[model samples]
Target chain A: MTSKSSRREFLTRSVQGVALTATGGLVWSYLLQQQAHAAPHAIRPPGAYDEAGFNAKCIKCGQCVRDCPYDTLKLAPTGEMVAIGTPYFIPREIPCYMCEDIPCVKACPTGALDHSLEKIEESRMGLAVIDIENCLSWIGLRCEICHRVCPILDKAITIEHHPRKLSKHARFVPLVHSDACTGCGVCEKACPTEIAAIRVVQPELVQGKIGEHYRLGWKIDTPITQEFKAPKRKDGKDTPATGLDYLNQGEI
Target chain B: MAVDNNTVKPDTVKLGPNGKPVRPFVMPSTLVGKLKVWRYIIYRRIVQLGSLLLFLGTVHWGWSIAGEPLLIGNLSSSTLFGIVPLADPFAVLQIFLTQHLLEQEVVIGAGIVLLIYTLLGGRVWCSWACPINMVSDLASWLRRKLSIKDSFILSRNIRYVVLALSLILSVITGIAAFEWVSPISMLHRELIFGIGMGWMAILGIFIFDLLVLRDGWCGHLCPLGAFYGVVGKVAPIRILFDTPTCTHCSECVRVCPEPKVLNFKKAAEVGMIASGDCTNCGRCITVCPENTLAFGLRVQSNISKKSSNKLESNLRRAT
Candidate 1:
C-alpha cells in the first residue's frame, strides 16, 4: 500500500515538473517574440536570404563574422535585440570590401548566405541612396567621390550631367542603379560630407513594390499584330476605331 | 592481511562522527592510482578550455592558427583544416525545423558529431565540452562547501519537455529559440566579443543552482544536454561496480552530481551501473574509499569473472 502511494506521488510530481518547465518555455518564447518583433531589421552579410528565410535558416554561429577579412561583419551583440549571435554589419563603421571570392558566404556552414551567388556583384546586401540636398555635387562642387569608390565602378553609379545656371561646369549627379549595385557601402564609407551624402538602406525598406495586377504590354519584344488577332465587335458595330481615327475624331 | 598492515596507516584515515573513515576528496597517492582517477577530468578540462581558446584566438586576435585564412569558425559550426565540416546537432535541428531540408554538408557534419558522441557517450559533451558545465560545477562545489541544505527538487525528465518545447518554439517562431537565450552560446560570445546584458543570464543560472536547485540547469532544464542524454542511452563505456569490494559507505552517492546513476542497491544486484544518465565523469570512482568502482565495458561474460577476481583480492585483504 505504501509502495503504491509513493509511486502515485512520483507520478504527480513528474507531471507537475513537466507542466512547470513547459510554462517556463512558453514564457521564454513569448519574451523572445516580443523582443524579435520590436527589434529593427539589420543588414545581413552578402548573399543572405530574405528576412524570414534567413532567420529560419541561420544558426547564429558567427562563422560569417570570423570569416570577414576586413572585420566588416560582427555577431549581433546581446543588447542589440536583433537575433542573438547572428552576424550583421554597421556600414558606417566598416563597409564590406566586396571580395571577389566572397569569403563570408563560403564560410557559412548552413546555407544562410545563399551559396548560389557566385559573383560579388550579384549580392543585393542593401541599396545605396544619394541624398542630393546634402551632396556636395548638388551644391556646385565637383565631388564625384561616391562614383569613383564604387566597387562596381560605372556600372553601379554613373555621373549624370546636370546643367547648372550658376556654375560653368555641369553638376555631376551620382545616380545609383539598383541592378548593378551590391550595396557594398564603399561609396557611403568614402563620402566626404560631414553627414554622409549617400547611405546604404535595406532594399526591402526603400525599394517600392509594384502592384501585382499591373503588367507592361511593351515588355514583349514581338509585334502586337503577330501575337494577337483583332476580335470582332460583339454588338455587331463598326470595327473598333484605329489610333489615327480616334485622334481625328477628338479633333473633329 | 600482510599488505593491508603495511599500507593502511591509522593516521591517514580521518574518522567521521560515526567512526567510519572520511571519504578522501584529494587524488590517490600513487601515480597510477592518480592517473586512473584524474585522466578523464584532465582531458575534459583541456578540451573545454582549448575549444574556448581556439574560438577566442580566431575571432578576437585574428590569428591564423588554422593555417588557411578564414577557414575555421566558431564552436557552433566550423570546418576543420578547411575541408572536414562540423556543426552542432542542435543548431542543425533548428534549421531543419523551419527549412524542412538539411543541406548535404550540414547533414554530414551532424552525422560525424553524432557518431563521435555515440562512441564516447553523448552527455560527454555536457561533461567534457560545455562551458556552462564549468559554472555549474563551481556552483555544486560552493553548495557542498557552504553546506546549503535547501534544494528545490524538480524532475530530471523536465529537460525532455524543455527540449521538445524548444524545437516546437523554433518551428513556430522561425528562430533558433533556445540558442537565442542559451547561456552557453551567450558566454562564448561574451568571451570573444565583450559582454552586454547576456552575462545576467549566466549569473541567473549560477544563482539558481547555488541557492534554489542542485544541478538544475544542465540536469533538469537544458534541452541540449537532454538531447545528448537520449543519444548516449546505449553508450558502452560505464562505471562497473565490483560489489564484493564495496563497503556500502555510499560515498560515491555523496560526491556524484547525478546520484541516481550510482543506484547502489541496483548496482549490487546487476554488478554494473547501467543508467544512461551516467556521464562517465569518473567522480564516483574518485571518491570511493574501497575503490570498488572503475571504468569498464558493460559486457555480460566479463562481469562475473571480474567480480570473482575482485572478491578473492578483497577476501585476502580482509584476512
Candidate 2:
C-alpha cells in the first residue's frame, strides 16, 4: 500500500515538473519574440545570409569572431535583443581588411555565413551609400578618399566629375555600385570627415524590394514572341503556319 | 548560557574510536585535512578557472607567448595553438539542425570532444570546465551555509525533456533557439564583453538554485548536462565501495551533491557504484571516514565474485 501511494506521488510530481519546465520555456520564447527586432543597420560579417535566414541559421558560436584577424567581427551583445550571440561588425570602428582566404567563412561551423563564397568579392555584407551633401569631394575639396580605398578599386567606387556651382573646377562625386561593392567598409573607416560621409548600410535596409508580379523583359535572352509560338515542322520550315496546322503536322 | 549541574573538566576531550575528536559536520579541522578533503574540488576549480583565463588572455588581453598566441578562440569552438580543434557537441548539434551539412573540420573537432568525454565520464565537463558550474557551486555552498530548505523540487527527467524540446524547437523555428538564452553561452559572452543583460541569466540561475531549488539548473533542466549524462552512463572510472570497511556512518551521503548516487546499501551488495548521474566528483571519497570509497574500474561482477569466494573459504576453514 505504501509503495503504491509512493508510485502515484512520483507520477504526480513528474507531471508537475514537466509542465513547469515547458511553461518556463514557453515564457522565455514569448519574451524573445516580444523583443525580436535586431539593430537594422548593424553590418553582419561577410557571406552572412539574408536577415531572416541568418537569424534562423546562425548558432552564435563566435567562431567567425575568433577567426577574423582584423578583430572586425564581434558577437552581438545581449542588448541586441534578437540573435544575441550572432556575429556583427560596426564598420566605422574596424572595417574588414578583405583577406584573400576569407577565414571567417571557413571557420563558421554552421553555414550561416555561406562557405560557398570563394572570393572576397562575392561577399554582399552590406552596401556603402555616399551622403553627397556632407562629402568633401562634393564640396570641391579634391577628396577622392572613398573611391581610392575601395577594395574593388574603380569597380566598387568611381569618381565622377561634376562642375562646381561658381567655378569651372570639377567636384569629384564618389559613386558606389551595389553590384561591385563587397561592403568591407574600408572606405568608411578611412573617411577623414568628422562623421563619415560614406557609411555601410545593411542590404535589407537599403536594397529595394521588387513587386512579385513585375517581370523584367530584358532578363529573357530569347525573343518574347517565340515563347508563345508553336515549334516548326520537322521538314525544317522557318515558322509554323498555324497552331492547328502545326499540331496536325506533329510539331506542337 | 545555562550552566550544567554536572561539573566538567577544562581539558576533557571527546574522541571517537579512531582516536580523533568528533568533527563538526563537513568541516575539516587542519589545513592538511581541508586540502585532503577538497583536493578534487580544488583540482576541478583550477582546471575551470585556468581554461577561462587562457581563453580570456588570448582574446581580451591579447597575451601571446613565444611568438604564438596561448589559445585563440572562444568557448563554443576553439583551436588550441592553431592545431588542435575543440568543438562543443551542443553547438555542433545546432549546426547540423540549421545547415544539415557537417563540415569535415567541424566533424573532426566534435569527434575529438565526444571521445574525450566518453572516456573521462561526460559530466567531467560539468564539474571541471563549464563556467556556470562555478556560479552554481557557489550558490549550493551558500544555500548549505544558510541552511536554506528547498522550496521546490524538480524531477531529474526534466532535463531530458528539455533536451528533446530544444531539438524540436530548433527544427520548428529553423534556428538555434536555445543558444539565444543558454546560460553557458551568456556567461562566456559576459566574461569577454563585460556584463550586460546577460548577468540576469547567470543571477537568475544562481538565485533559482539557492532559494527555490537546490542544484536546479544543472541537475534538473540543463539539456547539455543531460546529453553528457547519456554519454557517460557506461564510463569505466567510478567509485568503488569496500564492504568490509564500511561502518554505515552515511557521512559520504551527506557530503555528496548527488546523494542518490551513493546508494551504500546497493554498493555493499554490488561492490561498485553504477549510476549515470554520478559526476565522478570524488566528494564521497573525500568524506568517507572509513576510507572505503575510492575511484576504481567498474568491474563490479568480478570484484563481487572474488569477495563471495573469500566468504566461502572463511566458512570452510571454520568448519
Candidate 3:
C-alpha cells in the first residue's frame, strides 16, 4: 500500500511540475515587461542602518527596538538568526521623516548608526523622486505643498513651474525637482488623493557617505591671531637688528 | 533441642507430646490480601495533577491582571517558555557564555535551579512537574483512542534535528529558539500575536504528534530527553526490582511507558532502575500481586542487593 501511494504521489508531482513549467514560461514574459517599465517604489534603505558592522560584533539584545521613539522597530521572531533585533523601518507605512536631529541615530547605544554627523545634510536617507504622471501637482493643480513644507527646503525639495493644459482654471504645473527631494515621503502624505498620487522612491542614498554636494555653511576654519616680538640678547642689551648686519647681538 | 514459648521440645518429646512448632506461628489471616487501591497514590500522579490544577487556577485567576507573575515573566516571545527550574542548565550555560542574559539574571538564576535539580535527582522534573512532560503523558493516555502507537522508526526525528539546530543557532546568534517548539505557544500566540506563521508551525508539529506519534513529540525525539538522560546517570534514586521474586511475569515491563530500552529487565544487569524515561508512575508496583516492590534509598555497597531483598521481605511481611 505504501509503495502504491508513493508511486501515485510521484506521478502527481510530475504532472504538476509539467503544468507549472508550461505556465511559468508565459508568466516570465509578462513579468519581464513589467520589470522593464516598473518605477521604483518607496522603500527603506537596504542596509540595516543601525547594525552595519560585522556579525561577531552584534549581540542581538533588542536594545535598538526599545530605544526607538516611533516604536516602528521590532525584533524578528526567534530562529531568524540572520536578522534578529536589528532595527528596520517599513517606509510606506512609517517612513523616516528625516528629522533634522535624526533621533534614531542618537538613540542607538552602539556605533551601529554613525553618531558623528549632526546636520540633516550629513544624513543619507535615500533620495526621493516624484511620479509626474501620478503626482497631484503635475495635474495642473495648486500643490506647492511639498516645496513649502520640505524640511531640507531648497536642497531636498524644489518646484519647477510648467505650462498647465489639464486644469480648466489653472495656467501652471508644479514639477518635482527630484535632486532636491530627500525622500522623507511627507509629500506622499500631503497629497489629498485617494491613492496617494505622490510617492517616495528607492535606491537613492545611504548613511556613512559624506554629502559633499550640500556641505553645511557654518563650518569653515577661522585663522588664529598672532603676536610679534623682537629677540633679546643674554646680556639684556637692546639688540640692533639689521637686514644683513646684526652688530650687537652676535656674541650673546 | 530447646523448648520455645508455646512450642514442645523436639528431641525429648514423648509419644503424643511432639509439639507441631506452635502451628508455625501463622500470621494474622486478615493481613494476607491484595493491597488497597490507595497503594497507587505513592506514584504521585495525584500530586502532579493537583499541582497542575493549582497552577492553572493561579494563571487563570491572576496572570491576566498581574501579567506574568512567575519565573521569566511573559516569556511570550520565545519558542518554549524556559520556565520550570529543572531543564534550564542548557539555557543558563548559553546565557553566561553568550552574555545575552546578564540583565535578565532572574531567568538565568531559574535555569541554575533546574541544573541543580538535574544534578540531584534523575529527571524527576520531567516525570513530576514539567508542563510539557505532563502534556506529553496526557497525550500518551489519549493515544489509545487515536489507535496510534509510537514506533521510533516511523516517526520523524525533526524535533531533535531542530533542537540541535536551535542550540547551534543559539550559540551563533545568542537566541535560544526552544520556545518556538512548545505546544502552549500554538494556543497562546493566536491571542497574543494575531496568529502568524510562527504559531502555525507549532500547530503543525502538534497536529503531527496527535495524529501520528500519539505520545506527542517529546516521547520519541526530544533532545531535551537526551539532556535529561545525561543527568539521570548520576541520580542516586532508582526503582530496583528483586530478581529472586521477580517471577519474570513481565508485568513491570508490560506497563512501562518508556520503550523497552528503558525497561528494568533490560536495564537491571547494569544496576540501573529504568532510565530518564521512567516517569515513576508506579504502574508496575500497582499491578504486581506478588507484592515484591518497594521504593528505598541506596545504602552501603554490601547492602545494594540486600536492599531489594529487604524490600521484598517487607512486602511479604506486610502481606
Candidate 4:
C-alpha cells in the first residue's frame, strides 16, 4: 500500500471519487423520480391507501401478491411500469374477485393495505367508467353482463330506462353509480366485447367535482334553498322562474 | 503447536508457487478433507435455498403447518407461520428516515431481526441469507479461476458514505431511496414471486464483480452490508484468534472475502478478530492449517486456548 500520495495525486483521486459519486447520484435520482410518477393507472389491491401513500408505505415485499387467492395481484417487475416491486392488478385479465375476507390486504405487513377496511364494499381501488357509445345496452342490445357480475349488485350498477329511437319498448342501460361502486373491476372482466365497454380506472381520471356552489334543489334530498325561489308580483301572484323551466313548478 | 514455517510436516498441506498456503475455497485431495472444506458453504446454501423454497411453497404449493402458511414475502419483509413478522432493519431505517408513518408490524419485525442479528454477528445475513451473496461469491470464484485482478481500488468505507446518502436521499425524496433501486431486492423479489427484468441488474453485478474488481458490489458498495457491519460491533459471536499456534500461513487472508478484518498484528494483540467489518464467515477458521482461528464467544483477552475455554465455560454457566 502507498504510505502517502503527493498533493496533486490526492487531489486527483478526491475529484475522481466525487465525480463518480455525483454521476451515479444524478442517474439514480432521475430513476426514482420517473418511477414515482409513472404508472398512474395501476389498480392496487383492496384497502390500498391513496396512490402517494401506498407508494410511500408499500415495502414492495409482494406478500399481498402471494396471498391473493385468485392470482389477481402482481408485483410490478423492475422495468415493466407500475412502481417496481409494488403490487398491482390488470383488471381486464383477472379482476379482483372482492373476497369477503380480503386475504391480499390482510397479508400486507405494512399498512399499505389499510386494516380498517373491514368490509369489501368499503374498498375504492378505482372507479368503473362506461364507454356510452360502444356499450351493448347503449347500442340497443340486452347485454348487461357487467351489471350481472358486479358483487355490489343493483346498488353499484343499476339498469335504468333509456328511450330508444325506433323500438316501442324502453332500453335498459346499465348505469354505474359512484356512491355504491367499490371499483372491483368485475364489470371490466365480464364485458363480452372485443374491447371491454366498461373499464376500471383511477377515479381522478374521469370524476369531476361539481364544486361547492351548484346544488340541484329539484331532488327530494336537496334542501329548499331561497336562491332558486320565485319572487312575488304586485298582485300577490308568484311569477315562475324562466330558466330550467321544468324545475320551476316546485310541485315535486 | 508452535510449528516453524521452515519445517512443514509431511501431513500438513504445502504452500502455493508463491510460498502462500492454499486457499480454503480450493477442493482438497482427500475425500474427507473435501467434505470438511465445504461444510460452511453447504450449510449456507441449505439456509439460503431452504428459506426461498419455504416462501415459494407457501405461495405456489399451499405449504402450511396446521393450516397456517409458512414464510411469506422476500428478504425486505416477511412473515413466518402467519404470525411472527421479520423485516430488514436497514430497509425499515430507510423508510423511517423518510418520516412516513410505518405500521407496528414492520417496526416489530425490524426489532426482531435487529436483535437476532446483533447477537449472531450481524453480517450473518450477508453470508448466510442474502441472495446477492451467491451472485458475488460466484463472481469471486470465477475471478480466481480466470486470474482476473481488480482494475481499480475502492475504499471499503465507501459503503458507509452510501448508507449516509441513502438516508439523506430518503428525506429528500420522501421515499426509501435504496429500497426503490436495490439490486438485492430486485433479485430476491423477482426470483421467488415471478419473472422480471431484475435479472439484468443481477447480471450487471455479476459482471462488475467478475471483471471490474474482486468482491466489488458486496464488499465495497452494498450499504446493507455496511449497516450490518456497524450493528455487528457489539456482537457476542466472534472469530477467536490463537496467535501462538499461528504459522503465518496467510491462507485465511487469501480465503477471506474481507481480508483486512484479519490484520494479524491487531488480531494478535486483541486475542480475537475485533473488527466490526469481519463477517464471521469462518473461512479463516476452516482454512488455517494450524487451527489458529475459531468460532467462539467474544473473549476478553485470552491468547491461549486453555484460558479461552475457561472463559467460555464461565460465560456459559447458569450462575
Task: Tell me how far the alpha carbon of residue B19 in candidate 2 is from the true structure, in angstroms, after superposition.
Answer: 19
- Tens-digit lDDT string for candidate 1 (A1-252): 999999999999889877876788779889767756543457789999887777767776777787788989988767775667778887778999999999898878788899898998899889999888999987769889999999899999999998857646678789999999988899999999988989998877778978544445587863433222235679876665464444445566
Model 2 chain A worst lDDT window (10 residues) = A222-231
What's the candidate order when arranged by decreasing lDDT?
A: 4, 1, 2, 3
Q: Looking at candidate 4, what is the lDDT of residue A11? A: 90
Indicate whether candidate 1 or candidate 2 has the larger DockQ.
Answer: 1
Q: Give every collision pair in model 4.
A: none
C-alpha local distance difference test of each model: 0.77, 0.76, 0.45, 0.84
Q: Give the per-residue lDDT digits (tens) of candidate 1, residues B1-319.
A: 1222112235555543224464545666899988877677777789889888876776677556447533256556776656778888887887788754555777788778888887777787888888888899899889999988756657777788888888888888877777767788788776776667787888999999999888889878898988888887776666788766665566677767777777655676667777667777777787777777887776751665466567657767776
Best-to-worst ranking by TM-score: 4, 1, 2, 3
Query: Docking category for candidate 3?
Result: incorrect
| Steric clash pairs (candidate 3) | A156-A180, A156-A181, A157-A180, B79-B179, B79-B180, B80-B178, B80-B179, B80-B180, B85-B114, B86-B114
B-chain TM-scores per prediction: 0.80, 0.84, 0.60, 0.87
**After superposition, which runs of candidate 1 have C-alpha atoms over 4 Å from their true positions?**
A1-22, A35-40, A165-170, A212-252, B1-40, B59-66, B69-71, B300-319
On lDDT, the stronger of 2 and 3 is 2
Candidate with more favorable, higher TM-score: 1 or 2: 1
RMSD of 2: 7.8
B-chain TM-score of model 4: 0.87
User: What digit string (tens of lDDT, one per residue) describes model 3 on residues B44-116?
Assistant: 5665565444434333343222343222111221211223322245443433433342324335444565555
